[model samples]
Target: MALLIPASFGNLAVSRRAHVSLTVSASANPRTFHRESVDWVKETASFFDQDKRPIMLFDGVCNLCNGGVKFVRDHDRNRRIRFEALQSEAGKRLLMRSGRAPDDISSVVLVEKDRSYTKSEAVLKIMEYIDLPFPQLAFFMQFVPLFARDSVYDNIANNRYAIFGWSESCEI
Candidate 1:
């Protein structure tokens, strides 16, 4: 199901698990394989235990992205994060509601009640929920201006496939 608000330039997609993958070269480089479209809605998807916490919408097949999730899951002793693929039904719903573009990221997103964050801002927000050492980074990230931070993030996003590699039709 694709939820698109054409007037608002908002589009979110939930692909049924077809297990099919599409391979494309990175726009930043032609030598890398970049696949980020995949089937992700599971047999069951619920928002239980997610009411007051941050919703972490991430890329499901990116090793780096998934690894980040694992790190958060391991450190989230308070269970403060709710995991969802941006390609899942619930995820697409929330992203659209939060006013974020669906296919516009290579990093995890942190969705709070009244706002959404991306790139470094989002990562720092997630860090706030993690343990000590991680939280420390949040404070440092604050020293960087938002524009600078976002610029760096964009560079990484544009180069993620070249640097990190991607599976065929990557999904999250």
Candidate 2:
């Protein structure tokens, strides 16, 4: 499952030069995808805190996604969630292992010991781990039509870059 920030029209808290400013320069949002799913490859690995906890896979070049990561990190009081930038070795591998299309990198991918999900399914699952009002939204899972739910999620994913702005790929 996944989580969300209530949609709004305020100016984003992200930057436009992107992360590449830390390095050199490159522009153009690459649209071509090379494969169906990155998961076909051998599964990659991740770092754990002293105790074991799952991390999330995200687009590192996306300021909005990164900001979301920070928000999750800050709010997850149990420190139950960690992170994996979608561009990272582990992030890509997890995407594949979870049965998501590599080139389709749209949803917030979660890697538990077993499986993964996309769109509203994934978002709602992420909320489950966070507890409280987030987990409460899980109830919506039973009543909403999948197409109706996913269409909304799809619109948001497709427009995310335009709305949030992106940076060059980064290592953070």
Candidate 3:
């Protein structure tokens, strides 16, 4: 049997064998849907250079989230990732385009050229994009069951503010 799931980026087909695939149409432009206005999309698309870098959306007020972004930046010597606070205009737009609530700041989001990933999946993708050791580590982590990985991610995300504390102001 096969299960069809509709996503903002594309249609996902999951088979009983546990195989899953995503198919995005050629005409579906992520930037067009993620931006409020066509003009803004055009301008920001050029300014951000989305083609060359993946966008990371993080909870700006969460201390742990800020630290994670900082860590990614420090390690990403090749500058493969671009960051935006989930509360920021650009981030909110992307969240909306991805069919997530703008106020849902619990999970880290990774937006690539044609698709988006959240929670543990997002973390793994970000690791793969970063240098050497991380890519090797991410490849190993991929062997872990998705549900198990995401469950752990959710537990930490749900208690992140209490455990790591939150800031009054949103930091980069």
TM-score of each: 0.67, 0.67, 0.72
- Candidate 2 lDDT for residue 142: 39
Query: Per-residue lDDT tens digits of candidate 3, residues 6-105?
Result: 2243343423121323343324465554332222233234434636588999988889999999999988999999998877657755665555654567
Colliding pairs, model 3: none
On a 0 to 100 scale, what is the lDDT of residue 36 in model 1? 31
- Evaluate model 1: give its lDDT: 0.62
Candidate 2 Cα outliers beyond 4 Å, as residue runs = 1-52, 170-172
Tell me how many residue pairs clash in candidate 1.
4
lDDT per residue for candidate 2 within 1-172, as digits (tens), equals 2321111212222233332112100121223222222223222433432535776787787777878787777668998877877655456446656665333357777776645667777777777878577777777673698898899988988888899877777535
Model 3: how far residue 66 lies from native, Å: 0.3
List model 1 lDDT by residue over 25-124, tens digit each: 1122322213232221111123433476778987765656767788899998889888887665555556554556444445667876556787889988
Candidate 3 local lDDT, residue 75: 89
Give all candidate RMSDs, comma-separated. 10.8, 10.9, 11.1
Quote the positional error of residue 123 for candidate 1 in Å: 0.5
